[model samples]
Target chain A: MHFTSEPRLADGVLEREFTLGEIPGILWTPESASASAPVPLVLLGHPPLGLHKMYPRLVARAQRAAADGFAAATIELPGSGERPRSATADQARADLRRAREAGEPVDEEIVDRLVLPLVDKSVPEWQDALDALLSLPEIEGPVGYSGGVISIGIRLAVVEPRISAAVLFAGTVVPRALFEEARQVTIPLHVLLQWDDEANDRQAALALFDAFGSKEKTLHANMGGHTGVPQFAGDAAARFLARHLK
Target chain B: MHFTSEPRLADGVLEREFTLGEIPGILWTPESASASAPVPLVLLGHPPLGLHKMYPRLVARAQRAAADGFAAATIELPGSGERPRSATADQARADLRRAREAGEPVDEEIVDRLVLPLVDKSVPEWQDALDALLSLPEIEGPVGYSGGVISIGIRLAVVEPRISAAVLFAGTVVPRALFEEARQVTIPLHVLLQWDDEANDRQAALALFDAFGSKEKTLHANMGGHTGVPQFAGDAAARFLARHLK
Candidate 1:
């Protein structure tokens, strides 16, 4: 199933949708053409707290990237993101399954239109977005990615070849039962794990990091608890992107 | 007048007090080694809400540092690190007058410490602590320091000759009308500023950093709104200390 929507402007940011595989995602772009050149694209995958608008820093990072010659875009997954368009629980479950399999999730939330689904098995949804992203115009190339709380999103970004760099803030991992594909990915990965992340979530992140046998992986253990996309994270992400993408 | 307190332990973390000229401070240290080897000391200075218990990650940082052959501490400015020891309004005001030269308005709510008689302002409290620290049989020659929220503490660390390195997390400045001593410091300073810091605090930090004027200054604009210490500041602080001290 494919879903699409007309691009809308909230405040000044642009919100649009495109198809990735069989799923669709809301694309958040900076309202202004502030980039000095064809900037590196930052694909932001947010968490599923319904407070997608709380990503002021993400928006700010995008603006900073624009200021620093980088383009930024945020994608909403199925069952969350732009508008809640889920037909039923079965549809939600099916969307989740597809996301896990295809690496692209569906989006069906109506709030903020810029947030991500919070689940841990939406790899397919992410892939769908990645596929769609490659098809977008004026997006530049060689993407840098970041996410808050969404472990699956981090995993997707890390494993996906198109993602050259990634900063996972308070990341977690999918249970082995969910995705048995836990191996080392070659992409540069920076995991900013909050010391006081959710007990289970912390375990998940540790396990995932342990499973990731990449030599380039760096873990920054933060003192503050689970702060999603913390402002400090923006600078850190920028540094990571600079190191990996540039 | 110099204020001092014997080193004590709270929750197994080392705690002490000292006078910086006329200002008093309550310092908290992690329960690590006091061996002859120089250890990294992270001085945590809380927000204007006055000093509360040290944040958990800070304690953890201390623990990690201790494990990594470093010592960590948190200093409560007499005006605020500990909640219960703040001076009364009249005594505080009197101390401010006696130590602050002449007419100066102190924010009692933000900086109220247990009132005390005025002490001489010429004596450097941080230098005094260094003297005492060097005097300790267990302390070695190399020393490192970092602070947060309390701009004065960071200044104290920066200007002192013994402090080999410093990281000031979410620091603020003293109004020139109150105390303008931060500008004299030249140290390897790393300033961590919260993105959403409170009114004038961000500006204060920028001003302080500009004053410190270290060639190695690194400014990290974090995502948290006025929270002291970003999620990953400890790791960065540790790296900073390691670089400068060892």
Candidate 2:
């Protein structure tokens, strides 16, 4: 699991078309890696608010992971993130169904049931795209997802054993029970928080960290409102991935 | 329209409940008033975050207006300021329909077509509540509505003849073409904007003001971002209302 700084594909990152059940996703792969070696991959999620396009820092985090020799991909959720906005949640659900059908290599049961309902609940489709991307073949075991407002995805990581690690940033942990379940996760968990966040998403992250009860957990404080993945966090995430994977 | 201070309603502001269509709203009316005949009113509206209960500043603004010899009411949008989370746009629309059906003496057609759709679009429902409140018998002519993110409400005022004067606080304005059909409003308009507002809602306000083609339009700059109605703004709004209405 030693990630080399060399390209596994062409460039440090390569965008390849991937399917999660029926969902189509573009995978960002490190060109320097070996196919035989098990690689740690992450599915970076985004919120609705059309803020998906605004997440340059999260995209860069993926690049940093690739540069550190981990396979990383930023997937646009169905009907979101360079995808057209669906007039209704039903239409978005339909698109999600198609994506689940197409994206076979990943866990469709999670995508169809728990994940879709969460996405339909107005959690934002960009988050769903991350889930779809993680289902791809190039990124199977030991995955992580990151977003400033992605609490549900954290919950997903807790329930799905496939997720070996998770990074929750300025996001809330909901239903309380989700935190209890997340505590059962045998993988490393990290959260980046801002005290200035109005929604107290940072507070929720702390609660989750408390529940997980593992010394492997880390919390980084950055100044700003509840949006954007700070570049300052990129190096920390890289080191954490390297430690956990290799 | 000269707004000045009045006596306390009770120990503080009196919470008034009114039905717009079928939707129920809690209006806080500040008892502080200057014994003036037929006092002008300014209806303060809340955003989708919740009901007026959560917005202390908006309630305070209404109280300040009432103290300035103007009757002020901050009405909670239905289904908002009520629960843990604000109601969705569609829920607000259903409430709008109920408000109209209840025969609350509001502009039902406007509530049904324009205002409801706008609220459903997440533009904010306080303007519609203001519209209904302005049409009430307790309110005198030359009434206005003010708030941050006050663009849609401004557009509603531009089209609806009932709104005689408006003081936008750190507000943004929608495109003039949306309000084009009802162009010739004789009332005065004051837009107070901040430099650090999201996406420069102030600049958007300026663009709308420029397109308005009215000499009476005023744009003032403040030092805050997405601020609640400031105390000093009460005097300024009072002055504007007095100049236009008296």
lDDT for model 1: 0.53
After aligning candidate 2 to the native by TM-score, how far in Å is the CA of B244 from where it should be? 59
lDDT of 2 by residue, A1-246 (tens): 212233334445764554444444445677654555546777665654333464465556667777766776554454455555555545544555565578633333432443345444433433455455444456545666655444455555655656667676644324455566656665666566654565444445545555664435545444445664344345555655665655
Candidate 2: segments with Cα more than 4 A from true spot: A1-11, A49-55, A82-116, A119-141, A172-177, A213-215, B1-246
Q: lDDT per residue, candidate 1, B146-215, as tens digits?
A: 6644445544554566666667664443544223455555566666666455533544555555565454
Highest DockQ: give the candidate number.
Answer: 1
- The segments of candidate 1 whose C-alpha lies over 4 angstroms from its true place after superposition are A1-37, A50-58, A81-121, A171-173, A177-182, A199-204, A228-230, B1-246
